[model samples]
Target: MVELPKRHKLEQSNRTREDEKLREFDEDIPDLRSLVIPWASMVIVAVIAAGIVLYNNHCDGEHSEDQLFFQSSDTMVEGSSYKESILERFLSAVTVEQHHVHKPVYEENHPSLFPLTTADRLGFSFVIIGLMVAAGGGIGGGGILVPIYILVMGFSPKHAIPLSNITVFGGAIANMILNVEKRHPLADRPLIDWDLILVMEPLTIAGALLGAFLNKLLPEVLLTIMLVILLSFTAYTSLKKAVKMYKAESRALREQGLKPDGTKESELTHINHQVEATDTNKAGDELLKDMDLQEGESPGTGDMESLAADKADELQKILDEERVTPMYNVSLLVGLFVFIISINMAKGGGAFPSPIGIKCGTYSFWMANGIMLGTIFLFCVYVRAYLVERFKAKERCGYKYVNGDIQWNSRATIVYPCICCLAGFFAGMFGVGGGIVKGPLMLAMEVHPAVASASSACMILFTSFTATTSFFVFGLLDPQYAPVCFGIGFIATYFGQIGLSILMKRSQRNSYIAFSIGGGVALSAVLMTIQSVLSLAEGEQHKSGGICGKDS
Candidate 1:
């Protein structure tokens, strides 16, 4: 046979060399410095907790958890002195100074802010730990925070939900501020997926506003059941998706005659990008046809050898890196309306009045424009998002990423905002941050668990901040707890974020861990549902006679 062309041989050799390099490489693992931060953080928090509890216990005389210098009053009824009629409540809702600075006084006849004692010490520790776990994994800590306040501190749901959200705002704020810092090693691509956050934020805030309003509309039992179902589905779907992806990936790699690693399938996908409907190498095919009858003893071997000698697949392996997958616009529009209703409801039944709802009837005077501004901003996000993306007007974050096993889908676009809207609605309606399960849902959609969790952490901040603002607007989040709970919670949450950054950065495969966290959250939701049921049952028992009581 005549010599093969030098150009073809050079190209063939290059393909072989490149493929060998790709097959041999591995990503580097994170080093010791990453471990130091989380360990030190744990020590500092533990020491402070131990010292504070010891000091408070040693100085103050033993007191019951219920021991308070001031007690909450019921049925104030907006007495004859002030005309807080339903109409007046509506007008004054935005005008009320619910966030006034809280004064702490234990002197004669003076009201106290949050009382700090042994019980508070216990509460502070538990709250910090729970939030740390949740925030580290990109949850808002609402899953555990609600139960902490209700069960440990004896707060009613009305009180606990708002307080928990307001408390988590501390952590979210801390993490947001930290996100701005460029000194961190991973600053180039920070954990906060701002691209996803931008799309999800407004919808989530709007939902929180509406849900806060919806808080009083439902019976307590219904809310409990809904949350339990939502959480359970989140956990189940995440585990199921992870397993399915792993198996599919394994099978594909097996067929490809490659040992499975996380990177192999993505490499094959990169190769797939070069495949086209029409054959690309007509000249090469024609040249081979002329040589087809030549050397191989077997007639079949001649054509097979010529086909194997053609190196077109190797040459076309470069992927089309950025592929567009559009999100459904109709779902987003529907979500927008839902968010507005939730927000209005959060304004002390501004949209729909309920007996248990706060009525903000005061005419707009100071800060009344907040709702209007927020509404315009949220609606604008929905309307402008498509235009911005379509025109390539400015460089913004992409809504979806196509990573190894993870990719974008229109369904994700529809499902994601719907979840946010629901979470927001309930957050506003019940004063509880509902995005705690958002991480799991994102994971189920095949996002890298770490990225999903990070996105969750950032998004929860918006949900919590918005919900807390409503609580402040409606006089639900007492300013007294601001310093102790919100302030302290903020510091604790910052540390949690730090710990999370260190932990997530070190892991190469975090899907299993992420799924486990989701499972734990689902279990927590189950407990919350049981608690809601017992609370209703106990109330019924009170209406009837107690077990031991004789008719008086």
Candidate 2:
């Protein structure tokens, strides 16, 4: 108003614009702290109540000595005809053995709907908290779940593994519900990558089956040690990624002349139009530079407008191509599910009698596995071909890619799924969810945090539900407590998803998602190691039988 200098007026205008942008960003960030506490408390209380009932049953001696922990090595050696050498004894003592059979400790071992007890309340609280956090990261939290179920809830490994699967299935359902309609942050397509799901899930399931077989062969001590090491590494990598993202966001804020905290000095209205215009102009300038026109020539308004229109049309086409149709994907998945279930039901598993009476270690049982493997192999080949073709088409069309859009080239289609198979193997071997490994793997592949979370959740939905169904068939899931655990998982996950969404929007930091993943993995490593140590200290011994031998 007082005849300011041109430079001074320009500076003032720039500052005002920065403040307006910051305010707009901050408005979208809601205070979700209030919503978090109550939901978390409810989860804690529910799990604790369940824990009490389990603790009571354990105290009542419902669990046999073998069921309470692994069979003692000394007891096994006592029955052996030949005396073992020192090395053999050491190996036997240190080894962890898992059998295919699952005999329930009691006919009615599931917890009552609302049991009251004081035992393991703190452990129960941790389990609920871990589930909520893992849900935010699009994981099943099984790494934490199985360990807690065994160590604190007094569940045998046989029961705990299946229960963990059920809980993860419930959480996956919640995540899928939230993600199905959500759009990708940078594209018009759904956030859940159906293409990724189709390509990875079959191989993942196959790997899980293989891993479960290997689990019966491997020592528990070795598996436990491997899990701790792998999870610890994953946690470290995820946290490192989070830290890098945080620093990058801070740098961006500084470059924009805005405070990292998003505080603004002045209130403003109708800044959206200005911001859009500014962004469009910047984009146009970038486009013109990329064109590399004659040194003396500048883009005329008509030329610029034409280029912008062409760009818009190209973008529209890319989006249309990328938009997923669930029909084909779902069909393939359903078919795989049916085939796998059929095989498992026919061959029998653990305590669930085979419908066709196929005994374990028989030629029929191996044949069933062979058929399943062949089916998965054919399915993977088909999906891989489809993706490679799609990727080629995209390349030919000059597609403009966004962050986290996987270039499903032939090599990628092959390599990534193989990595996923390994991830799934670890999942089955350690009795955790594949998401615990795959979530970090996606991040390592440079997928956007939102896309990684959504896609991983979708994958978990498939894998966990499949495992849950198998457990249900095998009579491993506790009817009374299964529904309760599932409900808690659903509610906790719903709230966790909502809270993380708000926080990410408010802080404009995708790094929070990575942090959640890292924290969950790290917690799992500690919990599992503790459980293993406890078992070892108690002189727990596993029954290591031959692959084709009778179930111990």
Candidate 3:
């Protein structure tokens, strides 16, 4: 190797350097397919497995929790009043002797709307209108439409839940379309956060299903207590929000250097420049502190830094204030879950409980619908009156009303009614009070809380009507029990209306509904667990006894 020429050796060294650089470059470049494929496959497999597990847990099996299948709990027997215990024992006996022997016929046959008799059709139509009217009345200081429907119609909570849900479904879709097409307010801006809504929906639906099941397993007294507690909480929350709004408004006025009442506009208008100068001075000081450059730092550098910092801070503040983070979309799901758990504890009846056993008749469905529709009509009328009176009141104050014209063609008019119809359809299929969703949608459309609540009532009633019609069409309606359910429901509904009216006058109405629903869901979940465990134990006892006591 020592015999090589000097020039050749130099060339060899240069070649070696080039080779090393090439090797390093090659090392930096990864194999695209080999690097990504395995990880992608793993992710896909994991997702598939998770989905299967969730389906098994929530959707599949003979008694899917989503389908509202549940057994009454053992704890339901505890703390029973003497009268309640006697009634429970009798019901249990009847359930064992009658219901257990003959699986409910209606449950097996999904109903269509074609076979509804003229009387049933008329009755249901009236009820739908009535529900709407009642809802309006409640929100406008009249009645709580939902409870009224349940109590008056004698329609089991399960049936009412779905019926109400369909209305919300329809109404939401309609509103979305109108917002996009007619109003154009939500257009050209990513105003509606789909990500939040998507995340929340499944949770809410799951909660609703669970609530429905729990309703089957629990007792009524516990449900009532939970409702009361929820009502109180809602009232408190509403008041808290109102206070917060007032405080925020006051703070804003003070920041603008205006009087609290904003009566002296001229005195405050000249302070804008002074306020700007003060803000600048403060921002400059902050900049100097951030740079580790003290008060003695070069005046030019300090000034520049302060200006930059001031701009950054201003931008940050603007961003924070302008961001539209929606609480309703996500919170709705949580509330729904709460409701599901609580209502189940009420342990009412089912959507298609044994037709031969206790058919909640067509009239029951009709009355619920009627209440809602009637409420809507009432709301429109009330709103018109309120607007007129408000304008007159303003005139009396020496200020002509600037805007008395209600925008009828605005997006809300179309969106709200549409949401009602869509929500109504699905709700009927599921047998629920789709009002939960409808209430929020109504609020979003800038409807007054009262009107929104009333609209929800109206929508729910129609949904129930559609559902009842379907049930009857499918030969699920039992005529004999119809009168009895309607009579009982009528009283209950009326009472609910009166109670809700009293609450609304105090501005504590909506909260009551929210709290009642949330509490009801939670209570139902507990009751269901208790009932299931007891039923299992009972089965075990019977197995050990070998001789059964003729099944209750």
Candidate 4:
């Protein structure tokens, strides 16, 4: 009885030491709340400001520049022509007219690429911060980038868009480099789900193409309203998801007889070790009994050979599981990317002069688009069939799955890709990065946060690179500032990834990843809304041009 009490005391003392160790680990992680709260507050304030601007614009009776211009010319019509004029004015009020062509102002008033002014320095600082946040969340940060370039750096919208794309490309490259060798948190395989990428990316590109076409027809104010609504909803959903995950994690820790913030290693490792020992002992006893019952001439030889064979098979299984992603998948994704880029280059809009002279709304232009869509459709069908076959095979073999693995069944294969396409459509229409939208979507799907971040980063790498190349082809990217921005993006993302990894590990909370993702989206929403409101307040008229008009 005395020895039993002594043993209990010993266990209690060890538990105390483990608790102290966990406390020390928690202390090392920085308080992320300090960063998250202020940003959330900013988002709230920006949303209010946007609402005010929208209300004022609605009440002012001059909602668009086209309306004002048409109203001024009303006296030029009389009698029967007056009714026609009224009808034309009504049409112009409801739909943006695409009949005029004007020269771009940037050609005459282009700002210096590497200015040494105070505002330029301040803008660069914000860009660095945005890149770090974006890199950590696996987003491209274009929503943040475009606003800073236009508002602070004195760049016109045309120039700002390209610069943002190139900067995001740099960050995407950094994220891909960091994520490529990362392992899944609970599995022995890679962090990035190549299957998910193969299924989602092609459809995303297709949706982007369609959205880009619509962008030419949509009014600026309408697009702004839509963007704000979408982003605000996404931010709310993401933060709510984060909070739910945090509570679940805390409850799990409490059930294991640990503090909410405590590490699982101490108590959980002890229990696991005990269980493993018991299992080993049981297996050894069974093996000995089987050897005793054997009628073989050589004692223990057959049993030893059988054990070796079993070990070999287990080792081979592990090797197969840990193997690199299949080369065929890599090749297919590369081929799709190349094909998409070629199609875009051949039938370009905006600042990119088309190589094939394919005018928008023309037969040739529509044909190019049709061909692109058809190719993507065929490829998606092939990939879907392949995934179905693989999933069935895994089911037959009783394959085990790790946490956050999405079962790509028939319904999921169709539904998720369709959702991804919509996310991509928003991205292209708003001129934001695909990651800004897709990251939140992946979280909503209940994917593991780390795996979502890594996989999203891979998709951004492809999208951003394509955009950057298009910008480069058009000579829109400023040579002097491009390299500087690229270097900043690359360096910031590397440190961001390192810091985030340490924070997640020390805190024993994967929800921080969700917080990072939510934070980025919220910040983008705030910045983009502010930009839109500022434009409306300044009474800047959007340029009017037909979808098929020559490049200004």
The candidate scoring highest on lDDT is: 4
lDDT of 3 at 348: 18
Model 4 lDDT per residue over 386-450, tens place: 98776554433234445576766565678677777777777766778888888887886668888
Report the Cα lDDT for residue 7, model 2.
29
lDDT of 1 by residue, 353-432 (tens): 32243433224321333664466465655544554443221111111112422221233344445555554554454444
> Could you tell me how far off, in angstroms, the CA of residue 305 lies in candidate 4 after the best superposition?
18
- Compose the digit string of candidate 2's lDDT tens values, residues 434-518: 8887887777766788888888898888778877887886677777668877887788888888998887765566788888887
Deviation of model 4 at 169, angstroms: 1.1
Whole-model lDDT values for every prediction: 0.48, 0.67, 0.35, 0.69
The TM-score of candidate 2 is 0.73
Clashes of each: 26, 1, 89, 0
Which has the better lDDT: candidate 2, or candidate 4?
4
What value of lDDT does candidate 3 attain over all alpha carbons? 0.35
Q: After best superposition, candidate 4 residue 510: deviation in angstroms?
A: 1.0
Better of 2 and 3 by lDDT: 2
Candidates, ranked, TM-score: 4, 2, 1, 3
Q: Residue 269, candidate 2: how far off, in angstroms?
A: 14
Q: Lowest lDDT 10-mer window, candidate 4?
A: 543-552
lDDT of 3 by residue, 77-142 (tens): 335543334343323321221123423234422234347555445545444344333332222111
Off by over 4 Å in 1: 1-118, 180-190, 206-215, 239-347, 350-401, 404-419, 422-431, 473-475, 505-507, 512-520, 540-552
1 against 3, candidate with superior lDDT: 1
